[model samples]
Target: MNNILRAKNLGKVYRVGKIDIHAVRGVNLDVEKGEFVSIVGPSGCGKSTLLHLMGGMAKPTTGKVFIEGTDLSMISDGERAKIRRDKIGFVFQRFNLFSALNSQQNLEIAMQICHNGNIDHQRIKEIMKLVGLENKLQHKPLELSMGEQQRVAIARALVNNPLLILADEPTGNLDSANSYKVLYLLKDLNRNLGQTIVLITHNQEASKIADRKIEMKDGMIISLS
Candidate 1:
């Protein structure tokens, strides 16, 4: 198994006025290819901060984040952005879809913005099919249910064929039924597509869906199972 991501003694600090607030304190993590790992924590537990650091959205105040052997802190912002664009896919709690564009078009826009290049029709089709949204490709966001919209979001994350997926509270906006559906979809994606996923959630049941779950508290990891 290839170690796709490694965070060494990860730490982050935000300076406000004269105080230094530590958000993540010596939090280390490693994620291998084709693995589904969930980080579970309460709000303000620093899980989201860790996700941003891991995905290269923010630089850490201490330690280092390594993605596919590239040290996130040592690289230039443009280089990190390229690594993020080429290797990491992100899914947020809100289904960040374009309301005006249909599902396929939404995916097309993501591919275009990431590389400013042509779309891969076959890959798009395969991703849509994998997320079970093949029939909904022509439908706008408003036309689909919350669950379907989330499915589209997942497809959009996979459109680039990224090496890793970083999903933050992906089912936060869904009802229990929809949440279950979304979790099931994620499990299926991990198992069938062989996609590596690192899901961050406050929901315990949601975290259990992953192959391993790490619990965080007060800017540090407390348990892993």
Candidate 2:
């Protein structure tokens, strides 16, 4: 498989007064097309920071990130924003759904924003069904359970046919049963849709479903297998 993303000596540092906090340090990794890779670590390990850098949401303090062979650090902010909008999809722990809109409408808005008004109703329906939200299309986020809202978020992420899906603590807010449901859905997307997924989670069971796992500690990748 071809590499969809490549990171070379990637690092991030935050300054607080005179002290520098290293968030990520000298990480080199590659994610191939259509692979499910998970980064597992404790809090403050910079898992989310790595995902943000890969998605072009945050610039690395040192080193390079290449998405589809284009150097992300070399691109202008506007170009990077466009790259994120066109090539990457993000799912977060909060579910980030518009509470006022029904599930279908919420997905529609995502489609419009990603596709710029060329919404494909058929594709939207297919993705909704893939995430097991076909029957709950008209329900608002407030009316849905935590699991359902996350499913809607997953559907919205898939609506754009993104090259890579970045999920940050995707099941952190769910009960055990719902967590299993969401993980199963993510596995199915990898198996069936052939979507490239990069997930960051603290759950070991969740990390097991991934094809490859990287464990991080103190801003460094301690293990990769």
Q: Find the candidate with the highest lDDT and give its number.
A: 1
Model 2, span 1-225: residue lDDT tens: 389999999999999999999999999999999999999999989999998988999999999999999999998999998888788888999999999999999889888877778778888888888888888999999999999999999998888889999999999999999999998899989998799999999888899999999999988999999
The C-alpha stretches of model 1 lying farther than 4 A from their native spots are none
lDDT of each: 0.92, 0.92
lDDT per residue as tens, model 1, 51-135: 9999999999999999988899999999998888799988989999999999999999879868687888788888898888888
- Residue 18 CA error for candidate 2 (Å)? 2.8
> In TM-score terms, which candidate is top?
2
Q: After superposition, how far is residue 180 of candidate 2 from its true place, in Å?
A: 0.5
Runs of candidate 2 with Cα error greater than 4 angstroms are: none
Clashes of each: 0, 0
Model 1 / residue 169 / CA error / Å: 0.4
